[model samples]
Target chain A: MIALYTALITGAIMAGLQAASAAPPGGEFPSKVPVPADNPMTPRKIHLGKQLYFDPRLSLSGDVSCDTCHNVAGNGSDGLPLSFGVLGRVDRPRHAPTVFNSAFNTVQFWDGRAKSLEDQAKGPLLNPIEMGMPSSGAIVKRLAGIPGYRREFARVFGGKTPITFEHVVQAIATYERTLVTPDSPYDRYLKGDKNALDKSAKQGMHEVSDLGCASCHAGAMFDNPGLPMGTGWFRKFPMIPTNPTCATYVREYHLADDPGRFDVTHKQSDEHVFKVPSLRNVAVLAPYFQNGSVGSLRTAVRVMAACQLGKTLTGLQTTNIVAFLNSLTGKFPVETMPHLPETPDSTSMMQVAKLQQNQRQLN
Target chain B: MIALYTALITGAIMAGLQAASAAPPGGEFPSKVPVPADNPMTPRKIHLGKQLYFDPRLSLSGDVSCDTCHNVAGNGSDGLPLSFGVLGRVDRPRHAPTVFNSAFNTVQFWDGRAKSLEDQAKGPLLNPIEMGMPSSGAIVKRLAGIPGYRREFARVFGGKTPITFEHVVQAIATYERTLVTPDSPYDRYLKGDKNALDKSAKQGMHEVSDLGCASCHAGAMFDNPGLPMGTGWFRKFPMIPTNPTCATYVREYHLADDPGRFDVTHKQSDEHVFKVPSLRNVAVLAPYFQNGSVGSLRTAVRVMAACQLGKTLTGLQTTNIVAFLNSLTGKFPVETMPHLPETPDSTSMMQVAKLQQNQRQLN
Candidate 1:
């Protein structure tokens, strides 16, 4: 497909082909989202997952849902620098990453701690500050008591007592799988449409490719380049930390505050190593980097150029790259609000929350 | 329409008609919502309202939108008893009423402090424990900074400075005017469908109407009986506090704890007085009453019967009434998630929140 697309392109723009060829050539977004064989994608399961994703009852305070942070209403990530958890009780350290097209990521989470969307799904629910559901058994009991969910779980999974924590994550992962964004402007350009991007954006695309930005941000997703699942495409954020200009950004943004993948692996080599992030929707996703310290896309581009490539981009170069990044914004699918099911007689969501606490104590 | 539907019914059920005649006759939910003449409804305005309704930027925490509490996805009310404010720092005393069909109420809020939906819209934006926008000017300034919202407001309202506090409420109220729940089973029955309700529910319907529940829970909306806007249909909960059965409920649920209308009006007669709430989706709205003391619909019905009507209903009566209330569950319109407008370049929602705080302090 790449060869065919390349054949269609005029040779006049082949100045950066040598550099792009050394890196992986961009590919089209897959029409179908990849799903694990263990958790096959069924429409009912997806529907159930949508309900669960929107249902705030899963949280300790019963107000924060997956949509509360990674809201699908706009860019998947909430526009806030940091997302607040249940009842807005505690602040999460990192910005909640955009869930849009997250299924395509080889590993989930900024640290690449969770191998897949399923693993990522469970992390927040049990996380003390995020969803905060105490124990897995408590989640099962809490959901099972909701008459609407109980019936749904039975219908979807087709077994008695089907509302298990495993199925909960499974269903959510299935739903997240459907959140792929396709037909971005850059994609159209790669598909042989010369006019897809603005003149500046086209120049920026060539500039980035020639600068070897594609070496890390490769393939269609721009994060993982044909890496197997569980094999993280990890890269050190400040690749050229010794560079004078890079050291300035490192301090200003508190880039080294987090140990990154080292927090999970507990290894010196993994220090400051993080999953290569997708550039899709980066235009609207402001307050860039893991810590959400930077504010503008233009500034982020400049910072990245300095910190990673050890080259301070000129004003025109930064503008061009920003234009290029803006073209990655794609058409987001319409999110329809699902009718979440009702809890059993008279047991307010508050009581259920207390029940979770009690169950946690027992466990 | 009521007379026509009444004629369709057999004369066999005239036993309770005499008692019901003293109260308001049941009517079908109106196809249209009442809008103040001053604030006309428009599609563009409604669309803008939807964006604002879901935008968390209105809050001090920049995470609590109108939809955060009075969620329209399910019962319109969050299943929790009390809603938390910014950062979950404080708990609101009263239950956040369902926004569905709220436009039909003659007065807004449990205490009837706000005269109309437009007035109600303004209350939460600046309330320290709610949306927490500092002042009216701050709200205008906060919204004006967003480039997309600036464009949208200009298009919708058509002025150089279109993003005003008044216009914000106008758009939100206009959008809220569409949140009526119709085509309920009870509504179908009111439209002359004989089999719309089950036998038990039918019996329960007659029981409530004859028992004088209609005096307050009247008209198409079941909360205002042809009353002029701003004329609250206020009623004292636990009306006959002297009755032995009523005293038990009043004591157990702390029914008289709140000063209610007295809090707003400071009148002797207004003690424990509250605007009559609609029973439209009461089945799904658990943790009932102003304080959410009663958990189940059945228990709430029993409590209401005892406190308001001064009658200790039998289990069968409670069951029947609960079933009847369940039949009022209407077909909720599909809430389409609107693409909330993006904030300008690098301003994280967090920064906007801080601006609101500074504006508050300045005010």
Candidate 2:
């Protein structure tokens, strides 16, 4: 059932992607985000997705959720350098990217391993270091057992067989798509509101282009928007790094340990190459970069200048760039915590006991 | 500054407690719950508390929150046998009691250690196996550093020093006091609506009284309301030991491991003595008892009858009782997730990194 649903959605997504690709880039940011035909947003689906996103039952320990790391309240990131997973059992290899404005991104994750938001949602559930559900089958069984979720799935899917892993991801992806943070000061300035930006921020915006920052961090999203959604536009970090700032960051931050896109493709050329992250709400979300190694935005700016562009920025220039970055802090949507539905049986209890038993066996 | 505020509030709480104790216990369950005069509910304070309640930043791993255990979505309990704490690092010694209708309880926790909800909120933050903050000072410093929180504190507290451990707990408790699960079928029945309860439920209600089940589980809240808030009314679990079912439950569930109120009082008589939890919403919150050992309501009903009353109920009686319990489920208030404020500095990052380092060293 899930395979059929996935295939059906995939075909619809591919067609939508083609249509999205034909549209010219570098225009005013659309208020309405592009939605795939198959997984079109509905009130019920979004509500269910919100519940699932906040629910920790997705994890083995029943203590980790999508919001555990990508907190909607705290600039869509957990505000941790490395995310703490179930029972703080393992530190996630990379920093949790902000979910705010993620809908605008061409691809998901620092590695771009997952293609769409739907694809991205599935990775964390089964990742042993993340949510850590033993299998998709286990998740399906657990969710299906819950009476409230059964009703919801039936209502949303309108089928005899409603609950599936594919539908779960689709609902989650639909919710993720709604997480776009629109109407930032930068966005207002782009829309011909000259006075929207401060003097320093205005100067810094022009300076960013002059410094070649806009070459990659282009378009309304400040990511390479020309690339199709769920497609990577990889760039080599520390491209020309001989500076003391860049060298110190690499060593101290444990950046070398993660091979970036190389971990996904297993290609030498992909080494150190990562998808350009959207600069939206970047000021509030720090320690900067893939590893979350740098502590301050000013330090991150100085290092990025040396490593990526090889142009040493002055203290004043760094300060202005930071101000400009701060202007990207868009208005966040009000996200109320949804009251989740309860299970009628001991399925949750039995599942938890099984998980605890597995943990005991491992120990 | 915090000391001054605490002293002032303490005086007010004392006065309120005096008034509360003087009031007769068995009035038509007061539609309005008495609020502590000191930590009175304000829109700002309740809003702040709601945010704090859902915020995982309260946890050491930055993963767990009050909502993690007392989920508003699922009858206020996490629906787990043993509530998972920081990183699933340690299994909580007892099942997490539901936050719903908790304000009506005379005491907090299964052990009945904390007096008021304000007192209860502080336990998890410093508990090694719970939220696991290193110290109270650490929590204060973290919240103080966040500019938005600082402003909110100043607004809510109306003082130069707004961010304190006392204020944090006070706000959380104030919000918790509002989590009253009123308007249940049982509540309506209690208010003289004869048809409020179903035929089975009405029969079960009579059966419960006949079985002397209402001795401890008494009053409007289904807890002993004659006692003042925070005062313990302890009853020995598994009062009778001869039954094979009771013996098996004790052995299989490791029920003896948790010393119950004995751990708090160090009195031999306190052994296996737990606070009588309210029957409100009990049907939906399964895996019954302190150990969460019994998965089904039927099993729990049988165990409770054999152990507490020394009377094994028939299958029909148990089903009817379960129906009666289901009638206790109440309407939950629409609780939306709050957008938490961000820290202006890397204080959160530094703290989490320090905690991770400490964990590594301890391991």
Candidate 3:
């Protein structure tokens, strides 16, 4: 029995390796960032964004920030299925995805709701349950009231009355672009250092291609297959749900709980179709899928095989796929936590009427 | 009328300056940290503690870390009346104090319940409403399961079964000791750079002395007049609450809400008694007082004078004191955000029985 298992695994590894060698593998992440012509990257703007990203003053509760949900400090995720928002509201619809390498995505968010990173930045701040600002104007007003922020906006953006909702999102998205992590072991292996991956990981890397996982998770980001920016390469999760294995897993995890992209587009064809989430750093960002129902990466791998590909994975296959996914974990950039700029001796909370702010916002 | 007001202000400044000039001024923060003999400072332990500080896995909700409430990136205090804890519990009775310079604090917490920083570190993580670990054993179990944390703990605290709750707090407290912010404009002034503080700030400094604010807010930290470490300087918040003005203000702000130290000590004398909190970075830490009732620093200063000293200040006194407090806002040290350690292909959340963790924890 042991000899039969080893022979089958070896045959699978050889077949997978043959498929991987058919192409030059043009999935290397672009070293140069594609800057929006209107908004060039600047040190001052990045610095401004860092402060705004960490500042809770953006939230109505003054407890949540951009970092609260999409925390760049960790794996760019808060690790919860749905992050708690202002006043501790835990009704956030989806698991917060990692902000790392979000720039490489053709579109931001699971549903591909926002076309660009800048548009995605504004959604949570006004989401009532998320950052919970009443309106974009209210957020802008709070930023403008602070003299330091006002000066920073003017300096970074360089215009009369520059502390706009537009500028805030631009700065934040620009800062987020700097959050991409590179230099994973997978990249080293791709760069011709064969010894970068131990035996099992190499087998898993080839199996990922053989199992058709790379069709969606294609490229250095594992998000797109040479698509233009804003053109999301989306695919239906649980693509082969009619298969008995797929149907059984779907019913168990409630894979149909969310309508996915159908909610965004209100199109029947878009139902259950979600953006191909980057497999980069997927090992650390567990509790997988749209609903974050899956916790272990191995289970996610097994579920993907049975539900999406309609193949029941053997124990060896499951272990190997998990190993390859683990190789996606990359070196994170060191970031200095910012000292959020404060108005001297006063705060935006103080600007509100006396006991009303305490009643409305505080405990 | 203007001349008369100016003359009075000049006289007050001169009197305050006379009091300040009388002493050698022993309030400058000590340049070196006084490490406890048992938990000597090391780069490795500090590094380990930092990972623990930023890791949300320590929290039952997998959201709140040490940095969530006491965010070192901003003013150590989360600028809210009470910080929202794990699962967004906002029932925290008192405002979270700034973690900056907390090492110099005689005792931790508003009521001085914890005797040392190490003792205080364990409080929030286990508090049902705060970080909300089920128990110390559960937290230790969670940490031990993470291989990266296990290796780090073993390296930092050299013994078998190194991942103890005790060592966790020790490392955190040791890291907290390094959180001290030293060179503010006030510190620079104390270092004989008279010009570091502008003219208005200088006048405010002197008035702080004249108003007897220096009596309690004494020395470099403005916490105590040389109390030995571990001995808290307790004082009645509304020292002269019987004063009609003080009584009226108290009723409006609900200053008598929580029976401060009495809850811990259960002694009549300890009723409404709180540790004299350090005024190190008081300028940025707004929404002042125990309940965070007063939003403006001017209002807080006025309330302190009326409630504590039975003195009503002129407008100029409030403005000048606010300026002086602004000078206390110190230079924050740069901190790099950490990548929390993740187990190879598993997580503590996964170890919990399947869908039960999702039911208990996530949305």
Candidate 4:
């Protein structure tokens, strides 16, 4: 074991270090992600969740859809600094984070307000600023009004809890778990094919550790390992002094006023301590940071370097970081994504309700 | 040439007469279909149109998408005598037509009310019972509101016409033209490859001719070579003594209220003079006739035989006709259809306007 001690330090450092930038270039993704026995993933639930995602009826204005912000083909995030919510086309307080790998977060949201992905899924629906659904009961009522959803929910979650916010969240959460990014260049490099990463990408990865980003984004999930609320890695991100709401941070071009964990806990120490987001597909996801205050990948690295590590990154270092980030963009999963439903079901209860509503109004 | 002298009158009739059930197959699909220059077919336009065809936005209730009744998969028609429309959850008025080769229609729709596929495309959107859009203007407004849609329409249609109803129809018509069903076993059999079709299917095809179903459903595109509206044969269909609305056939379950062609023209001669729908893929497109009163392919054939040929079909004939109809079922081009715009601009704009309106009220 002691034949060559040159590997000792590297092994020790690498043992607990996350392989975030180390995955196969082109590998098969799991046909399906596993779910807890308590919440099984059925085609019915996924189908229901997909409908909910696309259904504008879920929003208060009957306009905002989940797919509006998290476009499946548009690299998950809607390529905006911040997403627009209901009431008006007002920008959200924070960036619209990618839905990918969200299942791994023990606590969801930048502030870790929600305890699980299910809880997180439910948050936007009830948020007056987002979907503006009157309440979870209202959401259930709307969903129940659609007969197909009712039938599907009954089939998947059992006939008992036919319609509930909990069921909706659970179904959505199950679907969310399947949104993992897979088979990036980093992954290929890690699987023993060293040529997967170009020279610059490898150099950039070395700089990632040197810059201390690994301190927070640490694990296969690229998030702090399931540390809830007060227990996780904590660091105060920079904030402008004068903001009364203390709600978000502001940079030169973009606004960065995400109070992060502070808004949820109201603890002084929690102020600006945002949950570290995964860097997978970070190259495509611009307007980085909790508030999306950083417009570019390189600038985001710079901000993180200056604000968290108290060091300004060199221009080359920033470019290298971006190059490394590009390595994390995963393979597009075409096979596992569900086929479009063969036909639009006219008999769907949602259709029935809409028809009834139209008839009644006309009469 | 002297080729005409070798054919005797009796010999000519026997040799020239093709089975009505069987069409000349084993030929390549025509490359040019006389598209108007303004709406030329390109790979991009067809691709975009296909997506729009399958998308549900064409419907008002957010259910009953285009593919609902005209099934692109599952043999190109919803296996129903009459397919439901918006609010027609339990009962449908007319049989959903097979879209396999609807592009060949000289005048589209069962009534021949529309002069072209483009005109036919607009029918459903404006029909109160079909898509149920408030107005063509509303549809244009809705589509124009979506950024992705704007981009796509601009790309496909040369420029944005503010996403007018015309654009929608044209796009759909363009897509529908590309849906020609591919070569079937019958086509190969017709190519002098006698072994292509099974003994039973070929035998059934001969029976189809003897029964005279091909008198109307004829040629490469089917229907009359000259008259697109009338059945292309000499024999008149049986009529009810009570009304000329039965000019073509005596049938129960006639929506006597809907005089197919008569409603469009207000002409007595047009009464019951429904366009002769090609029987290709009729096996899959069940619930036949202007009013989809017939439930099965066998029933449809029997009804046609009894009314047109003045002969009551035996169970054996019905089965044989069904076999022949099944021969028409073949492969259809399938690719990813267009998705509804995630951030529909009209919806978004309406949302913003509503917000402003609400804010003003609040103030």
lDDT of 2 by residue, A1-363 (tens): 111212112323332444633221223455666566678889999989988887778888776889888988777988877777765655445889998877766678898887778889999899877888889998898888778888888999877679999999999888888887878887676555878889898777767867888777766667774555656877888676566767776677666667889988999998888898877788988877887777788888887887888778988898888888888888888876677777655756556765554543432
Stretches > 4 Å off in candidate 4 = A1-363, B1-34, B58-64, B80-92, B159-165, B226-257, B337-341, B344-363
Candidate 2, backbone clash total: 10
Residue-wise lDDT of candidate 1 within B3-112, one digit each (tens)? 11222122223324444433224566666666677787889999999899888888877888899878988678877766766766444357789999887777899999
Model 3 lDDT per residue over B1-363, tens place: 001112112223333554647432225555665566778789999999889887887888777889888888777887666677765665435878988888878778999999788899999999877888989999999898788888899999988879999999998988888888888887677666889888888888878877788888765578776566677888888888898988988998788877899989999999999998877788788778887777778888888999888999889888888888888877788888776776544457644323233433543
lDDT of 2 by residue, B45-84 (tens): 9999988997777877776789878887667888887776
lDDT (tens digit, per residue) of candidate 3 on A130-166: 8889999999988877778988898898877798899
Better of 2 and 3 by TM-score: 3
Candidate 3's TM-score? 0.90
Q: What TM-score would each prediction reach against the true structure?
A: 0.91, 0.89, 0.90, 0.54
Better of 1 and 3 by lDDT: 1
**Global Cα lDDT for candidate 1:** 0.77
Q: Rate the local accuracy (lDDT) of all candidates.
A: 0.77, 0.75, 0.77, 0.57
The numbered model that scores best in lDDT is: 1
Q: What ordering of candidates by DockQ runs from best to worst? A: 1, 2, 3, 4
**RMSD versus native structure for model 2:** 6.9
Tens digits of per-residue lDDT, candidate 4, A1-363, equal 101212113222343353565421122222334345567676778766765665555665444556546654445655444455543334345667877656545466777777666767787888876667879888787667555566777887786777788888887777776667777887666555679888888888888776677776655545553343223445566633344322222335333445668777888778767766776777766656665545556666766666666666788888877788788877654422232222112222222233333333432
Off by over 4 Å in 2: A1-27, A354-363, B1-29, B354-363
Residue pairs with colliding backbones in model 3 are B27-B219, B27-B220
RMSD of model 3 against the true structure: 8.3
